[model samples]
Target chain A: MPQIAISADSYAAQFAAVKRTAPLAGPLASLRDDAFHCFDRLGFPTTRLEEWRFTNIAPIVEVPFQAPAASGGLDREVLDALPLPRSGAPEFVFVNGSFSPDLSDPSGLPPGVRVRSLAASAAGGAGGLDVLTAHLGRLARFQNHAFTALNTAFLRDGAVIEVDGGVVSERPIHLLFASSSAPAPVLSQPRVLIVAGAGSEVRIVESHAGAGDVPYLSNAVTEVSAADHAVVDHYTVVRQADAAYHVGNLAVRLGRASNFSSHTITAGGAIVRNEAGVVLGGEGGECTLNGLYLGNGRQLVDNQTTIDHAMPHCDSHELYKGILDGRSRAVFNGKIIVRLDAQKTDAKQSNKALLLSEDAQITTKPQLEIFADDVKCTHGATIGQLDPDALFYLRSRALSKAQARQLLIHAFAADLLGHIKVEAIRRGLDALLLERLPMSGE
Target chain B: MLEIRDLQAGAGERRILNGIDLVVNPGEVHAVMGPNGSGKSTLAGALAGRDGIEVTGGSATFKGQDLLDLDPEVRAREGLFLAFQYPVEIPGVNNAYLLKAALNEVRKHRGEPELDAMDFMTLARKRMSLLDMDDALLNRPVNDGFSGGEKKRNEIFQLAVLEPSLAILDETDSGLDIDALKTVAAGVNAMRSPERSLIVVTHYQRLLHYIVPDFVHVLYRGRIVKSGGKELALELEEKGYGWLDAEPAAATA
Candidate 1:
């Protein structure tokens, strides 16, 4: 795969702006410098790279997007109506990559659980400073990914959640990184780090939603670490505005006997790339990755997932679905790797796409590498329109042709919602699909 | 009421239902029986407006309107229903939703008020119980992962809930055991009224003993070869349809 040539001049202006607005000392400042230099060395990807062959990020790279201002002038009612943010759940809101304490609520967090601002925690001699520095930027590699490098270079504020050993959080944590832009196109890079300690269980919902309709870019990075015997359920929802651009990366690691599952839903974006990498680093661990992407009106959603089984007695299951309407396009590239020592590893992957129009399209590729002899790995990809039999069946039940089509489209998405655990998230997804699935100009 | 005047149709290049003319009055049970490849299913498909069958000639009228000219759903809302021989399995769509939406569509066409979820569920449960169907099946996806008997029972359950004026059963008792057949027949029998009509299509003469003209009509090679009273089914069962193939005059019926 050929790489894009990145000169220092590409990010020189943004790097200078970051240094002037917010400069850090100690390991933080050095980490930022290294990440910036790495980003400068390895610039934005082009279609030449095999991973980005189908999705072009030129729309994002061409625009000169300055760092966003504060999240002011947004209607509280409008902000309240974003759907991804739930009431009565411990909520944390971030505007344009800056943490908004006024809009956040962590009132009901139980004992041994803490939600702290990543920047504030990084700045002071924080209570969890060692934990932050140890795991931050560790799982998500910046050496090859320019987006991660850029996110790290500008990652001064985000949400850091820690579940102490033996703690169980009953309430799901909702982190809404709402972005609004008006005067100029801005770029918001938000980072989230979650550390679930030994024997602890936690659920987190990280949503990056566009609060305004103006054209902007949102690049987010989230890292989740599950210790021995810990359980973590994570959800990442990215529903941007019509003209917005988005790229979200999630990196997770599971320790011995830990269970980790992540549900990713991408409803709206002009050009969206969702990348998730999970590694089973210890024996007897189980990991599940579920995703559904809905696109319409020239929208392109690219999903890439990697499940790495590094130890024996590990199992991983991945299922990703896509619904494309109008002239939109979708791509799924899932890679699963089992190391030489990882015997008794069972893995299954399924990627299915439903095209609802003549111009809609999908491209899927599955890459699996298993060195172990006693491993079972299987994968299948299906691309099809709404089943004619199902459509006829529904229509024969007195549903109109349009209603039948919508029901099948809704069924394609509701099938994925059955796997989503959070009630609020499930309701939000239902509302999102109801709002977006009818965009067919027919 | 349905009136078919020399309806000719087929799947593709091969013609089936060649000059099929039948009139079904209200409060009547007409059994259309035939051997395999005799257009029993083709007739059902053609009448239901299924795309597989292309009508080449003739016409069908239902309730004083042109049935052949309407869409499948339109025909359905106009009180026409066809119980499929091999019901399609649709996942992620529950039976309650399907039946409720279907019932609402029919009711809406009749200018009747729609039923809410509670009222709809009550109606669905009552109808399902009458068919001996499990209430859990109402919440399950439409015939998905269901047994053959269960699938057939679900079809009757939907018919009972939708309350169509003309119900066409195309081989409804093909794969059913004796008990399921009785339960299904009882369900169908329970819905019989002076204002409703039935066109029971099957190959076996055994089903009529339970639902019992259901007038028996023997179809062969896409045409009705014989039509008679209830005693005809017993004679066909005793002598078999091979006797009809031997007779040249039987095709004129």
Candidate 2:
């Protein structure tokens, strides 16, 4: 077994134990073995790597986190504490990266939509085996990404969603995953696969939440494939524990004339890295990526997004915002790639960060690689503190200095939060953020 | 009532209000006229406790309390309002929300309970109607994408709602047309009472025609160069304030 050069201890034992605890069969077993070997060769990333220069994961790698015992049932503590969508629109719940049938409700799903556990679907049960094999590891760069390789090695059970051709689902599907790392620290790997047929419209809201303030690691991978003329709106909200590490990868592939928009909101974690890569593979396809991240205390929030325009007549738009207070730090790295054949492409990217304290820091990098001659690409990044004139305006209206600061901060967030369409989810997120914001010591 | 004793203030390195003295009693209107950069706005800003104005030596007493010692918000809650020359645009903060918060803070300071949304809306609608302002402006962000006339009218609407004891109009007529100026002046005139005072700072005599002042003071080079009754505004308007520049020794207080 090859050992990761960065870590003194080997993760081969954990892979073997995970296989013994929850084993796959046939092609699934082969896939897991391949992923395990890939992870063993690459290992945990360090700060020396260019992509990980600003993010260091030594604190997370040094910990000994074992895979939890096979999912017994839905964890009551997690179920009670989690603020699952009251929108009751076909919700699926997961505990420790494993799907829980008792908590998931797929009863009211429309006839054209299909929802299944990825593990069961991969095992040649409940049909659609060909689609599973064709797109399971299609987008995830497991060969280079250690965390994704680790997640794929332990890919036991996660949510799989499929939409038939020409079908439009008005109500969104909610996928909620809750990780519990109490008693002992454990690593949870959750994987999601979404496939949409031609001319179909679907929306998905995926939430990742940790239960307690215990030290744990959640490595997640989600792949989305939209067929020709398909429209997809996806949202990912991560509210992890302050003592936890959350690393998530989102890979989206768009077909001819498809429209895909994704909004990612990250609230808290010891260290959180969300990397999203979107490819416009077909002509006339459009992509939009919007993200908002909040950092307080000693937390570190990092967002790395890549948009690839490979075909002519494609457009992409991205806007990301970050709010940092206390001794926290944030990083925003946006890259846009236009292939040589992708002429007449238009892409706009903007990133803005608000620093609420002297110690809060942000590193923003925008990179555009354009090979096409006739393309319009623009990117802008701005970092600033609260507008003193706006604060004085509020204060001159009889508000206290603290009250003025709080109002201005809320106003700054309201512009981005207003983009959320779901009222219930928006309000729930507002409640979650209100308890944390106007962060103490500011 | 407001009293200023040799108020000296500066912006950055340049002194603006150099040893100025003024007294304003209740129910009286004082018009401060000046050419450009003659300390008209600086005097208003210093009285409102705005930043960037270092008060070198001055004592401003508002109703027996030292106004210069208070914070801007404290001065606001104490019923001192400055109608800004250039109203700031605060996107994402609704006008009604700002008004309600400001009104409640002022009311709370005066030992009065805050008005609920419904009650506050009724009061705001009444005040806005008096200014001929649109109700939709209250729902939009404060001064964001608002026209010049609309922004000025909104300021007067806020003045009517807050009902401060002393209202310092700092060039409120700078950007308004004749019709909007009439509406704003009418709104201010409606709030004129025996227990309230007004300090109208203007550059043109046209605004003073609509909202006539009881006293008019011509400011030149930071100090009050000339003080007189209402006729002085007409005299300065006819003379075009160039005489004050031509005659350096004609300074008066």
Candidate 3:
């Protein structure tokens, strides 16, 4: 392919060039080359696209990003300072996108459970290739988002784990992905493949942290497949990055009688876009998605989700809430589709946002597309400020003005956080969110 | 004691309280009755230091400080409360938690030791029982999904908990049925004491029957056009406010 004309230093151009470098030279190279071709054919999405009307990717497309640091990672002391999950919890650590065995827990893995980085899987014939080739980028169509395709094409080091049928894990597995934004505008693509075998259960916690003062972008894609009667609980948390950009995708394919739930908590990052897609490929499958985003200063956070039901007897429920202050902006787009053959589908979606400042802005869209004759689908979106009457009511009872406003916002965000089935994780995110409030305004 | 001197206040550009004068000494219950839109609620809002009221030319003193100069919470701290006509509903905030936070804030301002959760729970339970409020209400979000009767009762429940020195009930009887009204009135009557005063603002004299007023004032347009003893409320209830409108405007001026 001809060399791209875009800025060599920009994130968009650099990502495009990475795709051009990977080719079908060998068996291992062929997989990379195929992903690259898929990514090249589908470039960055624009506002003109129907699914991206409310989101304008022009600003993200113009910036160039260097690859993640290959050698030195963040200071160990700083990593310890971060509010990570308990150390005893089964953990997998990724330093600057590459999985580090020395920093991970490999023992006590359940039977049929496999944990390996994408880099190792590239060199050797491994577990995720078959599933990766069939399902990767299938739900999160890259034709619309160049960024998603780019991540898929150049994905090097992340995690790939498969659970055996009928196995249940006692301890939760945490994926800690951090990047050193030393070089300005560093770009990291972390790819993960999760397979929940039939009748198995697992919980995955994915978190991103950075330790550089300069700006950078962390682009990631995680694809999950839950087999028949399998259950998966996933949580993605991002926090405390003042000069960074994060674009991530979480896609899931559900089997018959399977259950999937995801909780997303986003408190920090200069700019972030979290995309989640779920395809209910079997009957009697259910999914629940909940999210909370608290942004201040000039931070911009967007959450876009889609749930597609292609079989009968499927159900999905989604709720996302945001609290925005200062000049921050938030966008929420949730779409649910019931295909013609997906009879008896039940879907409900809601997005609500509270703006605490006159300068803050929010855009929300809840969409439902149903082709099935027997289905129940509903969607709603609301954007407003804290109710003045409620504020005064709390104040009259003796809470200070600031306390009242903060309490109300917390209560608003709590509605979603309460849905987190995990106790430790819920409490963990709650403490972090409380300490972050009045963040920029105060 | 509570005092007002030629208090001229208005909501927006239109005037409401025009050159009004009233005083409520400790242990007294004063009621102000007028027809619809006669600035009765405006007086309560102004006295409680709500956001929209414009005090063009007047002074309101609660205890010994300027009440209008304080914010709503400050006014509440200084022993002033306004039972709103339509209490706001805050979802996800426990009713009991909200009450304790307010109580603690005022206590802190007064240099009192903060109550622990157990102490506050005991105190709240006692007050809720007085208003016949179920303990379940304390666990639910504040006033969320409450019926009109329940909302009014909740306001009185709060009044019993906060125990302000001077309480202003603004149209508290607007949506109550006879039974709920009696229960609410009884809650107010139970809270009445020599150390506290009450200012009841209403459109009808029905509420005054349960919580009788020491003094009654007739407010027309933005000004308290007439003032008299408690018997005047009966007179106005009998002879509508039409006479005040029929009289020459220049004469009232």
For residues B55-111, write the lDDT of model 3, one tens digit per residue.
999888888988888888988887788898989888888888888888888788888
Pairs of colliding residues, candidate 2: none
Residue-level lDDT of model 1, residues A201-304, one tens digit each, is: 99998887775557778999999999999999999988788888999999999999999999998887788899999999999999999999988888989999
Residue-level lDDT tens digits of model 2 in A1-442: 1223534244677777778877776677788899988887777887889899999888888777777667835566667676554477598888888888888787678889998887678677667566677888788779898899888888788888999999998888989888888788878777899999999999999888776757889888999999999999988888777788999999999999999999898886788999999999999999999998888888888999999999999999999998899998999999999999999999999999999989999999999999999999999999999898888778889999888877777677776778778676688766655444623212
Candidate 2 vs 3: which has more lDDT: 2
User: What residue runs in model 3 are displaced by over 4 Å at the alpha carbon?
Assistant: A1-28, A40-64, A69-72, A83-88, A101-145, A366-368, A428-442, B225-253
Worst lDDT run of 10 residues, candidate 3 chain A, spans A1-10
Reference contacts recovered by each candidate, as fractions? 0.65, 0.65, 0.76
Interface RMSD of each: 0.8, 0.8, 1.0
What are the TM-scores, per candidate, against the unseen true structure? Answer: 0.96, 0.95, 0.89
Q: How many backbone clashes does candidate 1 have?
A: 1
Per candidate, the number of residue pairs that clash is: 1, 0, 8
Off by over 4 Å in 2: A1-10, A72-86, A429-442
Q: Which structure among the candidates has the greatest TM-score?
A: 1
* Model 2 chain B worst lDDT run, 10 consecutive residues: B244-253
Q: Tell me, by DockQ, which candidate is best.
A: 1
